[model samples]
Target: MATIAIVYHSGYGHTAKVAEHVRSGLEAAGAQAKLYTVDAFVDAETGPWDELAAADGIIFGSPTYMGSTSAAMAKFLELTSKAWFTDGWKDKIAAGFTTSGSLAGDKNETLQRFATLASQHAMIWVNFGAKPGYSMSNSDFATVLNRAGHFLGLATQSLNDLPPEQAPDAADLQTAEVFGQRVAEATKRWVRGAA
Candidate 1:
């Protein structure tokens, strides 16, 4: 079975909710997916570094803050220096997800950071294949597809004013679920082909 590690930092639990939806898709796709919070790892308490190292694929996630990734995600990325130097994640499959307040809160920048980091590690980047959902026109009601229309990675939107528990919305989380399933299937194909 393929193993996927979800390393993320959710400042207000919105991202965490998205992560679970991703896990649902991953599990449905037949891969075992695990979640690792960057904060937990920071305290030297939780997180399975070994699982991360052994994972067939890794999905990086974080909230977009100040037109970039969150500080916690930044710190987590910084901690990967040892792995980067050793090419620990070389050739592994990598994807990214991000949550932001505005419909377009420069969340693409956050996804770009993840892709850049994957490139530096010599990892393969997975692109989001969904089209933009519900444009400026509310009558469109385009929500089943990629809501943000990000081709590089998954970009989810959450209302900043609402509670984190109810903000990501069903549509945003469903988009994430599709992204997760896509990655899982891709990983399975790559693994089986290599075998």
Candidate 2:
């Protein structure tokens, strides 16, 4: 079976919710999904390096802090240079997701940065395929990328101080689920073709 590892950092549990939705979607798509918090590796005591190395796909997630991923998640990305140098993740499928406080808080930039890191590792990228869900009345909350994004991007919004439970909303989770399934389905096709 294919395995997809979701590695992320959620400062206030918002990103974590998105990760879980993605994981659930992957599982539904017939792949084993594993969730790894950045703290699991950054804590200096508990790390899941081997688990990460064995995955068929990797999805990175984090809250958008100051227009980028959290410092902790960034550090985790930095530490993956060893794997990159060895080309350990060269052919794996990669995707990214981010949650932010505002409607236009540079969330796309954060997702793009994550995608760049994945590209540097020589991995294939996937993106959310949903159209922007905008209405004339609520254009501010509307997104061009919708729940699914473009080129392996997933964007979510959590209004100020409202927990992820309220921000990402059901629509965001639904989008995440679709993204997960798409990634897993693509990975399966690639693996079968390779064989």
lDDT of each: 0.86, 0.82
Global Cα RMSD, each model: 2.3, 2.9
| Residues forming the 10-long window of minimal summed lDDT in candidate 2 | 142-151
Best-fitting candidate, scored by lDDT: 1
Model 2: how far is 168 from its true place, Å?
1.4
Candidate 1 residue 30 Cα shift, in angstroms, is 0.8
lDDT per residue, candidate 1, 19-131, as tens digits? Answer: 99889889989999999889756533245666788999999999999999999999888888768888989988999999899888999899999999999999989988776
Which residues of candidate 1, in runs, are more than 4 Å off? 43-47, 134-139
- Give, for candidate 1, the lowest lDDT window spanning 10 residues: 135-144
